[model samples]
Target: MKKIALLVLVLFCGTSNAQKKKKSTTNPIVAVIITKTENLTAEVIKPNFYIFRNENSIKKDTLLLKAFSSSITPTDCVIKKFVTKSTPLYYVSWTEKMNSETKLKKETIVVTNVQIWNPATKMQVFSNTQTSTNIKEQVFLDKNKTASETQERNRNEGYNFTLLPTGDFTLKNKAVESKYNLNTVTMKYELPQKSADVSKSSKKKKK
Candidate 1:
């Protein structure tokens, strides 16, 4: 009888623990790679962004600092970009798919793809892909929905900055906040190997 009671108590404890865990959600951590692609005209580069976060609401700006400290090579483009001396560049993507395709009403999936590029090298540096589905799809849905309440889909997407001191990272949603101060961020290039060449280029352009 004692053993039966203990077993029941243990089962109850386990079930309660599982319920508690389900109630809490982990925040998404991410790095957005904002870039000025060659195709991007001056007008489109407005309010570029790079933000990081953990599961909670806490913002993590340190990821940007760490990325600056990391060094990237040409080959590392598969995961992150480091070929250039300056500028944060990335891709944008947003789409949806049938979550469970069948004859009747089809479920859907939301997805986004983005590419990061370095203007100086004219090479893509990093790209990130993400998907959100299930009940969250309704929340992820675009605000501009149709009158029938079907989601009005838009392809607008944001990129994650992948450069890190270690060349690898998993952003936490609680660590970052959306960046809105683009004008304040210092955007400049490292000095070239020779000043004379710069002067010559300037003179030629003037002529």
Candidate 2:
């Protein structure tokens, strides 16, 4: 009788551990892509943006798993195998460029892209891109033309985009979350600065 009790207790403990592990592993993970730029003045804002999106300064990396929680389970049983259910995974990405290039070519504007994925379903839930523009006002520049007026007149704008995946997915009986944490690989690089225009280049050559 004692041996039977011991076996039952061990089974119960194993089940509990398995459930805990499953819950912890089911949280979604995020991935990110970042980009940055330098010396983005009003005269060269477009060029800077082009450079940011271009090969050099663009960076891509997986997001660090911050905080996540698994779905609620309200039942307890010994030796009851709980098949893993599909869960949405969130991916966050961002980029930073000179927000107010003309205002402060030295500053940066940050942009982010987020996506939701579910391996169990083999589908994406949602995807979105967000941009944070850090507009810095220069009192010196404001003296010539009011900062507010310049900001209003300037056509430079900030925006965000989002999308939801369409289609259906099926879950399998073998679906199980791995306890081993996953990691994101990051790629960091710098954008290439544009060279002087023909007129400027010719002047340097003449000098």
Candidate that scores best on TM-score: 1
Question: Which lDDT tens digits does candidate 2 get at residues 1-207?
Answer: 999999999999999999999999894543221222231111112112111112343332222212212321111111111111223343323333333355333344444544333333434444434445544444445555644332322222333432223222211123321111112221111111232254467788999
Worst 10 residues of 2 by lDDT: 73-82
- Those runs of model 2 whose alpha carbons end farther than 4 Å from true positions after fitting are 1-85, 88-100, 103-107, 120-122, 139-207
Q: What is the C-alpha RMSD of each candidate to the true structure, in Å?
A: 17.9, 22.8
Instruction: Write the residue-wise lDDT of candidate 1 on 21-69 in tens digits.
Output: 8877664444333332333311111122332322344443212211221
TM-score for model 2?
A: 0.24
Candidate 1: residue 186 Cα off by (Å): 20
Candidate 1: lDDT over CA atoms? 0.38
